[model samples]
Target: MPSVEATGAKLYFEESGYGYPIIFIHEFASDMRGWDAQIGHFSRSYRCIAYNARGYPPSDVPEDPQSYGWELAVDDIAALMRHLDIEQAHLIGLSMGGYAALQFGLRYPERVGAIVAGSVGSGCHPAHRDAWLRETSVPSRIFVEHGMVTMAERMARGPARVQLKYKDRQRWREFILRLRQHSPQGMAKTMAHCQAARPSLHDLSHQLSDMAIPVLLAVGDEDTRCLETNLMLKSELPNAGLWICPNTGHAINLEEPAAFNAQVENFLGAVERGSWLRGFPATATIPSLVRSRGARRDHSLIQIDQETEGADVVRLHLR
Candidate 1:
């Protein structure tokens, strides 16, 4: 029941355990409950906080569409941190939340310890920008006309979500039930303004190229919409490491919680040990691996070999 006032709304957040904080942000189709698996695993060693974003129940839902935006989303994270008297915390966000985490790190570099961005960059590609905008509005209208039950069922079965349905039917059912409880009006406005109106990740390359915070960019191999954009993010962000889960989809955490949790713990461990290096060296060569046509299906992990000044090769493993 704990809550914090953030910008124009109040955000409901839950926390457990104690230590350096780790904040979890959910995707559009989920709420703070989506982070249950994370909180259970990480709370033993780290303070885990997950919050319901504005427009989700237990958080204030602003009626005006103008109240929802990418900037506001970024500010909400800051506001929560400030409200809790946290100087800095590791941020982990998924999909919509992932975009906010990246933007937050960019805007407030000094306040971030590290970032785990999962299943992001869906509508950010220029090639799919128009189609994304068109498709985004369809859900908004659906919510307004039919309500959460209809929208939740439809969205739960989306191509990017199929993996979860097949991998864990019970978990997928719970996710749909939670999604069905969201506010219809809040969802409608969020879909229209926040998701569809946000700027493309391609437009932020200049800023991402200079970011100094350690970032782990994670996405599912089957999440076709985000695959290319995540690759672009890895290339642009000097301090970013990428992870692509095999046979997975958009909800990587839910589909493969053990793998997702292990990868994150390792990243955080490296950061804590000061072993996480800065961006790739200026002379580092990133080969053109992606093909021009059709998706490639190589199970071998994407490895980047970087030769440091001491002639030691640092291998970056993207699994």
Candidate 2:
């Protein structure tokens, strides 16, 4: 097994093909294998690297509960890149992985060529932060008490994930099998430390607005937990383009692999050609629900509803 020593643990990673580097980061519920669909397609055209974050097996599972967290996860990405001698690479992450990729760009702006974050924010909303923290902690107990078997049973059918079950039962079953393989201790610590405690994206507006790296913020329209914050990300990130997979939910990359691959491929090509330029700043148009009263710069809502292949897509259009 190919692995890199990072932070206090060894991260197991897989690599293939040869071209501009692209690193795949997995969600909390997944390990490096979650990116198999992407790795197969992208490795043909890019140097695809996928790694298991610390605590995921084949990777060391640190015993200290405090060892796992959002910051540590970002550190693992930086460490992996440095060990691989990659100064910069395109980052593709989903769910918890999405959160890490976004933060990686913020913390290491100079080392990011581009970012494609799917279903990035779920429990980071301002209006429900406390509730999210409480809810996120509940899973830690469930994982420690009832174990991974119970986790796969519930998480696979979560509101944002059920779309995968409905769209492709076989794939969903594969997802469950993978989930079952994860360490219950790892999942518990992740929920308690990383998911429950990472800084809210809404709190990083200025830093997000200043980042010039091309970003593709992809999310499913029915992933209601992430929609508001995705809108916030679009409003703040200068070089971001939002893509909402209509009639879809979370596990988007799995539920709609072809669309996900195509959108990412197109975005990468555009960025390479210098066609994916920054969008106009919209700090003045932050939604009241998304921004603090003290941070408000504008008051009107500017939604641009678009249709591609007949599915309604909502986009921000500040003027």
Model 2, residue 65: what's the lDDT? 76
Candidate topping TM-score? 1
lDDT digits (tens) for residues 1-111 of candidate 2: 799998788989989999999999998888888888888999999999999888889898889977888999999999999899999999999989999999999899889
Q: Model 2 Cα displacement at 51 (Å)?
A: 0.5
- Candidate 2 off by > 4 Å: 279-319
Q: Candidate 1: where is the Cα deviation over 4 Å?
A: 278-280, 283-319
lDDT of 1 by residue, 48-155 (tens): 889999999899999988889989999999999998899999999999999999999999999999999999998899999999999998989889899999989988
How many clashes in each candidate? 1, 0
**Whole-structure CA lDDT of model 2:** 0.88
Worst 10 residues of 1 by lDDT: 286-295
Once model 2 is optimally superposed onto the true structure by TM-score, how far is the C-alpha of residue 9 displaced, in angstroms? Answer: 0.9
Instruction: Please give the TM-score that candidate 1 achieves against the real structure.
Output: 0.89
Name the 10 consecutive residues with the lowest summed lDDT in model 2.
277-286
